[model samples]
Target chain A: MTGNVRLTQVARRWDAIIIGSGAGGGVVAWSLAFQGMEVLVIERGHHVPFSPPDRDHLRNHRLTQYGHNVGPSLDDRRGMTTGDDPTSATWHSPLEWQYNNNAMGVGGGTSVYGAQAWRFKPEDFRMASIYGVPEGSSLADWPISYADLEPHYIEMERELGVAGGRGGTQTWPMPPTAPTVKGQRLAAAAGRLGWDTQAVPLAVNSVPYNDRPACVNCQHCVGFACPVDAKNGSQNTFLPRAMETGNVTLITDAQVVHIESAGEKVTGVRVVQRGKSMVIPTDRVIVAAGAIETARLLLVSQIGNQNDQVGRNLQGHYYASAAGITPESVYDGVGPGPSVATTRWSHGNDGIIGGGMLADDFVLLPIIYAKRALPPHAPTWGDEWKNFVRDNYRRTLQVMGPIQDIPSPTSRVLVSPTETDAVGMPRVVLSGTAHPESVRAQTFLLGKAKQWLAEAGAEQIWGSPSGQYLSAGQHQAGTCRMGEDPRTSVVDPSGKIHGYANIWVADTSVHVTNGGFNPFLTAMATAIRTSSLIS
Target chain B: MPIDAHLVPILRAATARIVPTDDLPGAAELRATEFILGFPEYADSYNAGLAKLPADFDLSTPDAQDSALSQLSSDDPHFFDLLRRQTIEAVLAQPSALWDAMGFVVTA
Candidate 1:
């Protein structure tokens, strides 16, 4: 039988119904389905095709000036506002930068992500304890510590077949891929500056493991699907394993509009699929629709918010980057160019509240180089621009990091008062800016990135500091933040919604403070930990 | 057709300014007009923007053409934004010669 459920199966009562088929939802499906619980996974977007290798230079996730290879469709719109006035909101398509879209296919951002599977630094969980919360910031310590999630991190790493250097007491499943030319150059630079550098923890394969082939080292890695089927994601790993157990069924192109409730517990989910609506009964309902949509779902359902804390503290990484040119060619036409990282600056800096890991950047497609990595003073049009790109394409090197943003209660997601999506459900309204401290932290990382580039014998360096807008994009988190007290948070430490018994949130929505590194591994580890506690 | 037959020359001329041919072929040789033709949503904008241009825009000198395109940027920035963005992307997308010229290696 096919793993994709039929219309008849949609009416059957399931043991659990998980909304979203992302990093969190996929792991939850595996954990519960292996225990013989009949699970139903509802994904809003269909699976992106891996074959034929969609290498659309303009339309992929990174350079979305035209469109995206995977999508929430152009019609899937949201409103972004500045103040409390809803009338002043600007409606944005999913393709627009202002919308802050995470990919919406079967595996969500995991499908198109670079898969930098980083474990949050030990100090990351105790942010407010180590460094006092800055004024006008909502930064706080997590209810759970890194020590509590360590085992789950190991399990998830093994599950995703992570290839990286060993950290404290844990070994990666596969040996790290040989360092890229840029990675080696930057690692030497870090050593000279008296900072430690290591192989970036990647979920992509280095050898033929778990039936997938080794990476072919193509340039089109981060934004496009892997041409070699080597990049491990929830779609290629946990979801398939969950399906193999024969206890889970996935329904694609099905949007969960609301979680139905009777008294105190969620009884079922109301899904809109292909213009038709249906109710699928479940004993437990897990909301994993990323950060923005997860809050919108809870708001639409009008549950888990007795204290009005369902959609506050929205956060995404504020990336700081610097690019420069070396005398020799650093580009070896290697795939997945980000192979080295330094976590020495993740915490314990002089005056910064929380810092971030610095790493070499991904392989820049020509279009991306033109738009993002090009120096500000460089010519935009005509022959000089063309000549500059041709000459410097092989010599450019960039260092970047995701600054651990200081969370603010005002930077939030809300169900729009007026705008509705194609299914007539209220669309999301994203508003507010990042905390001032977050901008300071980002600027600090920008300086560090430039130092690293300069140490590596760079001739000219240029990069802009990030401004304090709602930073949520691919690494979006902290909407339905987890806490010990229901008055200040939406979910409990175990991811259970505060007021609801059978409802929970298993995505980055429950991030108390998103870590200094990429958040996917932590999202997966947290999901595994949370699902194991579910009866 | 999404783009009018008469406007094709005008479209080509405007796109050429975005990524003009020097030693290398630019948007015009890379079929940016054909790429723009694939988007039906841009038909109205392309038509309106081309109509606002000088009647002899395609026949004008390179300096005169650049002046006309610059005028379009201020007159209707939305259309210019679309044209400028789409032309650059279309030119950058393919043609193995362009990839080789730019040192962009696309491995299978």
Candidate 2:
């Protein structure tokens, strides 16, 4: 049932009122529902669009023209910050602060994400202990280690029918999809450069598995809904399983306004269903509405901020790229790209506190690709510009990496006390940037990417730059960090709020350091781990 | 005359300068002026951005337009940024011919 509408009065209170039915909430919902617990999942956006993203090229998740591909109308939603206006002069410039571009449908970001599922390495957990803390960084060891979460990672992979092994070094439930033209080129290049390359683990199918079809190599993989339902996400996997258990009721388009809490215990949630507002009662509450919204909700509810640590420690991976026009056409319309990667550079770089995973570019939307891959000297709208794109479109290759970022308390999500959204909730405000060390590492990673692309036959190399701005794009994470110390974290090692036992946070918000790779799989593992300890 | 009659020439004049035609038709000729001003709010924003242009400055020539708009970019960049993005988005989204000319195939 979709929400933000008239509410049906229910006398029965739910066992768990899970917020944001994306990767995090979806995992928890399935786990508890399998145990026969009655769970209700509330989503701020509608269900995924029934049609494939091929329905509209001008408007989709990747393009984000007028509205969301699977979310509410864009005009209906407003935030205090516009975006990370990279081209703007000032840090808080109006042009650079688009605060809410995240997909918010029944599946959350997973519905339209390029599902590059990855597990964090052992070194990611003990950053402070191993490398020592850099200046102005809130770098610290995670309360839980990689070993503690490895089992859950494997479980999510199997449940989601994830493809790709450690390229023969490790094993998976299913094998990796065969390399595409670009992937094969990148792998060959990495070998020539003496760097190791492996097929990236994808939450997309290789062969037909668990009743889902194999990927057909449609290039619309990055930001479009799969027509065949092959791309595995919580929307297709966990959410369905949870509902099949007959213990979970999904309420879509239900924007959570506030938490009705009596001291540390959350009594229920105030929701705006359609246009009317009502309170849905629950015994326990789980907040999984991404890092920014999760922190914003906690701030508005005034429950988890008892120690003043609720919305702090905001961070995400800063992705930088090195794109160049290759000598030959590499684009064959294959899907969900940058299909090959090298985790060998994910860590263990000298003088660099952290490194990143480098991969080829994703299959891009046309306009976005044209806008991004233009040459420096070409005119913006002249014959030269049109000519350049025509000549170089297929020959272009972009090797990029989502470099791990350092955290600071200042890089945070705050509610604008003065500004309010349409539903009368305080608008979400984002400020701060990546740590200087992280920025420096991004520069280093861009050089590494340039090397890989050049070895792969890139002739005219023009690299994309990274900034020190707060990163909460598709791979956003780290806010509402989990730790043993209440002073430094909002949730405990088990994902319980510092003070309350019934309240839990199970998203990338719990990530201490969002690793060099994509974060959805890690977020799911954390969600599963949190659910196991939720009794 | 779509949303605002007063805004159309200004959009055509300004977007032509932003995306002037040298070999192929410029943004205005390619109907990108219609595209950059596709959204009502974006059109309004583009008009507001153009309000900062120097009086008596020629919108006819590329040099004159670039010189005039460059001065206001750092001072009031939000509007300029919106205009830049909207204009580029409009041009890039123009048609199959544009992609075909560029040899780029946008398909499902």
Candidate 3:
């Protein structure tokens, strides 16, 4: 890679240009590069290593500023003109959004994710076929099914070194490490409730597999970078491997402005690198900027919008935390990620209509824990508040329910009419309401959390505010949904864009619905599947 | 072991709360108080807020102590908030064996 290869000069032409070096783009780039294709990956964020992990609690105050972070505002789209417009969706930092949804960086959201690699249950792909669409919902079956993607899931797990137990009712492919004290407590409590609890299958190393160190059980795993190279992210996994192949060229801090297309075919992409705008032509352009950003980019580029489905069908895994203060500090210095999981709440039974996982909530850092201790009745300031923070920071144990939100046409990313980002691109305008069923599902899960916490000997407990404006959990999905009909979907079953033969989308944006679990594994699996086809 | 005079009171208070004198190897003996007080100033958000302190101001003086403490207590709720939070986190990050002997988490 040349130090000064100008984007304008590169506009001459290339074999492939993959936009966004996150889950999907990174995988596709690696596959294509290994196939001897000249590939260029343009990422808007800076490239930084996870060395000297930022464990300082104060630095982790806000969710959005967690890692090497950059992205367009959600309000930059056409539908929402001003922040005052009641219809406009509020935008938060993409990094911050990951705490609820996905993380971003050179590795994309995979950098800070819990790396709970679970294959989409066969039911997840055929949701509409199995459950039938409920009234007033856009629920539909995935263009492809679990059987079609199962091999790719295995490939990604092996490549990424996913660790967990295999084939219970859930079909976790890897076995888990022994439970920590907190995990044991959660298991005991869950058993008393007759709920199915198991050690969470994680992507972190268990016993020095793949030359990465085994997890030290630092209890700071979820949102913080692993000090040891145990947690598998693209930077430590695919991207490095791709680079070693000497075929992939990664250009960080190059924000793609738009995809220039002639009629049905994409000609090239316009990007801003080092404050200069230039166009880089390529034979094929893959949009994997993530669900929210990818949709916003397509909308901005005027690609895949003939049917107006590019930025439409947005979905996020909505989450709520139910917490309580126990007499003992169950928040003992255990590993940070959820150590145990309950799939009991994952599937609806006996006339129930929604599902979610009740997992050990361990994402809390010092600042967030202190802030959460402030109850509705507690004063925002003063000695009483200080004391409350001091006492409850260690005593609190929370259960986070990441429930699925039904897809809606109204839930979308459009360009805000008035707001422009640093590069003059229109900000993403998010619209939509929290699906009522989602709110109900979250409430049900909160009750389950209360039960667990109470059984674990909590003296006081509280539920999260209901129907809070759901933030983009970086688990954003369904923007460029995959469907058999080109008129209704942006990409085909093979992840190839309908009109452009060479172009493809391998991100979560192709998802028809956000699954009940975290979307990272699915995203990785989808990327692997797309790469197999593209190869 | 003698405690650092500058951090004696703060350490005394922290250890008193974390593991009282009646409990095994309280914060002072574990050097947890020193660990907390001597935590790199760079990691403290409070230091960032005080970046513009007057050139002539002597941080060691009694008046400066009162002024600094008052400012931290009044204008910066986030500072005290972080202080208490980090102190507890430090205590928790210590070896589980220490906390186990103190009867926090029972070990088999």
lDDT of 2 by residue, A1-535 (tens): 3333335743369999999998999999999998788988888877776463454655666666655576445444333333332122122312121445577787898888888888888898888898888887889999999999999998999998788866645577777866778889989999988888888888888889889888877767766788778889989899988988888888876789998888768899888877878898999999999998899899998877877787777777787687887887887767767578998777888888788999877776568776676667655543455566667778888888787788887777777766667788876677666689888788888889888888889888887566556665556677799999998898999999998868999899999988888889999999999999998
Candidate 3, superposed: residue stretches over 4 Å from native: A1-12, A56-62, A65-104, A167-178, A350-352, A373-387, A468-471, B1-108
DockQ category of candidate 1: medium
Question: Which residues of candidate 1, in runs, are more than 4 Å off?
Answer: A1-4, A85-88, A167-170, B1-5, B47-53, B63-81
For B2-103, candidate 2 gives per-residue lDDT tens digits of 346655666667667666665555577767667765567555566666667764444346677676666666778887667766666776665545556555
Q: Can you give the lDDT of residue A503 in candidate 1?
A: 86
True contacts kept of each: 0.70, 0.40, 0.00
lDDT at B37, model 1? 93
Tens-digit lDDT track of model 1 for A91-188: 88777765576788888888888889999988899999999988888889999999999999989998888988675445799877667999988888
Candidate with more favorable, higher lDDT: 1 or 3: 1
Better of 1 and 2 by DockQ: 1
TM-score of each: 0.96, 0.88, 0.78
Winner by TM-score between candidate 2 and candidate 1:
1
Count backbone clashes in candidate 3.
23
lDDT of 3: 0.67
The positional error of residue A494 in candidate 3, measured at the CA in angstroms, is 1.5
Query: Evaluated with TM-score, which candidate comes out highest?
Result: 1
